[model samples]
Target: AGDPAAGEGKVAACAACHGSDGNATAPIYPNLAGQNVAYLENALKAYRAGERGGGMSMMMTPQAQSLSDEDIADIAAYYGSLTP
Candidate 1:
């Protein structure tokens, strides 16, 4: 089973833009549901490290900054577990 508490709080920030169901409201935002874990992790890492450049890169940098490696892994797992 997944950690519901961490999923709730940690995913709260993501829900605003990504939606509670993981479908993005805008075309500019990518939908994360069912995406590959490695892909999600690499994207987050890229955004956090500024290797990926875009409006999302800026918005995600601060959010990703405070996340531990485990936190990222869990989130990737959670989102990847969701259905698109």
Candidate 2:
């Protein structure tokens, strides 16, 4: 199982734009609260691999690159557990 506790700190950087609870304050940023873990994992990996990001999304590439598989899973689990 993903460790939500660990993810809390791992996702702190994301909170700046995605919001502390995964609900982005900016409309341009997609709300990640209650998002699917598989989807989040894929997106994060894609962003890291430079296969799915463009424009503003590209900005996330560096952050995603810093994550390991475990971080992705944990962060995905944390955000997925929230209400959308």
Candidate 3:
């Protein structure tokens, strides 16, 4: 796995909606902290590949597009490391 701390900056855009702590202020956005790593990684991949659809699909597509496999792994680790 890559460094979780290094992925924090790349994930800053997510914090705007998901919150730095992953507790989204908006009810529509799901909380990401403590989410299952495999689930989170799969969802991101789905969004990037357009296999998922919803408001989040568009939002996440672009975000996930630039992420490498390692980036995804690190991000999943970072969020999974957080407490709800």
Candidate 4:
């Protein structure tokens, strides 16, 4: 139960890599559009907790660290609502 409208307002930073609509700006970044909300939530949480490790983790970890639970939910909701 996240507010997609509220989530839209919080995605400015993510737009640089993930694009405003959740599609990635480059091939290196995975598109978040239309992803499962649970998956997005788990991934964000893992990144924030430093439990996810990989090439992307180095970048995502720092980005996710500043997000609150509500923020994560909202962001995930926003992305999940988009078309892939």
TM-score of 3: 0.89
| Candidate 4 residue lDDT tens string, 1-84 | 778888999999999999998889999998999999999999999999999998789989999999999999999999999999
* Lowest summed lDDT window (length 10), candidate 2: 50-59
**Model with the higher lDDT, candidate 2 or 3:** 2
Report every candidate's CA lDDT. Answer: 0.77, 0.88, 0.82, 0.93
lDDT of 1 by residue, 1-84 (tens): 334345545787887888767799788888988788788888787777768776777789888877777777777777877889
Worst 10 residues of 1 by lDDT: 1-10
Using TM-score, give the best candidate's number: 4
Better of 1 and 3 by lDDT: 3
- TM agreement with the true structure for every prediction: 0.83, 0.92, 0.89, 0.96
- The digit string of per-residue lDDT tens for model 3 on 10-80 reads 67888888888878869999999988888988988888787888776878888888888888888887787
| lDDT of each residue in 6-65, candidate 2, tens digit only | 888798889989997999979988899999889999999999888875666767999999
Clashes by residue pair, model 4: none
Query: Which window of 10 residues has the lowest lDDT sum in candidate 4?
Result: 1-10
Candidates by lDDT, descending order: 4, 2, 3, 1
What's the residue-level lDDT of 16 in candidate 1?
81
Off by over 4 Å in 2: none
